[model samples]
Target: MAAALLGGGDYELQVSLSEALCRLTPRKDREQRTNQWFSSRDVSRAFCDIQDRDFEVDCRHFLNYVNRCHGDQRRVHTFPCLRAFLDSTELFPPKDEKLEKFWVDFNQTSECLSFFTDDPQVPSLT
Candidate 1:
């Protein structure tokens, strides 16, 4: 499951896995069978649309996807994009100690948007 997610394979497969997990655990609600099917083009369109400045549109699209899947289902595979969106919007639970540690590690490892040093024409801010 992790491999499929990391490899960017069929996202529906991930959603199916999540549904299976939910069935096994029996969360608050049963698995929703909404239009869970998505093609690569659909994903691409969603990816582009999410970048829109209108938060309402973005949130609606995101919630539509989430609602299509069973909420609180352990087996439901959450896309990394959803996780990122939730994190950035502070929509999820409050960040705990572990989350804080994750942020620290992520910030340390990820690249920052800084000016390149090779541009000789531009004066160095430092």
Candidate 2:
């Protein structure tokens, strides 16, 4: 995914996580004010802000981090059909609210090549 996103130098949108957060928050003015550049600490801070304080999405702690709510597992469970799998995260929400923003941003991103849909708790038979 990272390779594909960065592989093509043709990016339609170039914004940082914080800036995206700001825009989602209805603060586009602030988004333009901040620089797009991010340091390691900034990345860490953004990750922490998105995840539960106790959770960390890093290589070292990732296994334990998503133990309860795995992205891959959620995709499979929530999106059994190919369309659902590729279409939404309603079937696979983060464990909490902080994670929701991350999911929303992810779904809205062209890079992820996914979409946002009303994710009913239970997958539909139809």
Candidate 3:
């Protein structure tokens, strides 16, 4: 099973499988799952070690998902993922200002505090 290979210590396979899983996920639940995967500490750290091509694929998927989330009026739950990615990536800030602006606006919204303040009611997907 592909899930079993996740612990095989293969970075390339991990990246591929992670992307494939997200792509194959049902549309109705894709956003939450995608956010969970990227926000996972181990997965996020492993992504930083993958090849450029694989990294780009993951980045593209995240960007597309964010766009869809916004257009569908869905809440964005990948702030931790984005933060981790930014921390892992060196120099050369993201060119997309929209993403930056969205984060800024999103922070002003009431739900932003939940991301920092841990609540027992908010179940973590990770």
Candidate 4:
């Protein structure tokens, strides 16, 4: 699956786990960030096992569905489909106000591709 995504050439959407988390977290909470929040292996397995052509379309639909929910910032984390691509931390529990900021920033960002800047050292999705 990684090969497919990498070979697709439109993989600009694929950002590393760390890169995604770093944008949602502040420097002080950096120590709490762990790569184990969500497993890439699980994502690869789930994505590969699915036999649907409209997965991306379904995802967009789900996003819109969740966007209208009350307390969507915390509610967004409970779904399994989005979990496949997103990496999150338990350090900031659902009750933590910071978690709201994290999800808000994540949603506002360009599909979590913050590393696509003028810098030459672009991070890879691992």
Q: What TM-score would you give candidate 1 relative to the actual structure?
A: 0.21
Instruction: Count the clashes in each prediction.
Output: 2, 1, 0, 0
Output the worst ten-in-a-row residue range by lDDT, candidate 4: 75-84
Residue-wise C-alpha lDDT for candidate 2, range 1-126, written one tens digit per residue: 222222222222322322344334433332333233222344333333443334322311321232213344321111213233435543443345433332222322233443234556665798
Q: What global local distance difference test value does model 3 have? A: 0.38
Comparing 3 with 4 on TM-score, the higher-scoring candidate is: 3
Instruction: Rank the models by lDDT, top first.
Output: 3, 1, 2, 4
lDDT (tens digit, per residue) of candidate 1 on 1-126: 323322322334433444343344323222222113333444434423432244333433443353334344322232222222333432232333322211101111122211101223455579
TM-score of each: 0.21, 0.20, 0.26, 0.20
By the lDDT metric, which is better: model 2 or model 3? 3
Higher-ranked by lDDT: 2 or 4: 2
TM-score of 3: 0.26
After superposing all C-alphas onto the true structure, candidate 1 shows an RMSD in angstroms of 15.8
lDDT of 3 by residue, 1-126 (tens): 233323323333333565566456655665455446564554444433333355444443443343333454433323323332235542232445322321211322234422221233455699
Best by TM-score: 3
lDDT at 121 for candidate 4? 36
Error of 2 at 126 (Å): 19
Q: List the residue pairs that clash in candidate 4.
A: none
- Which pairs of residues collide in candidate 2? 90-119
The lDDT values for all models are 0.31, 0.31, 0.38, 0.30
Question: What is the overall TM-score of model 4 with all chains considered together?
Answer: 0.20
| Model 1 lDDT-worst window of ten | 100-109
* Residue 109's lDDT in candidate 4: 25
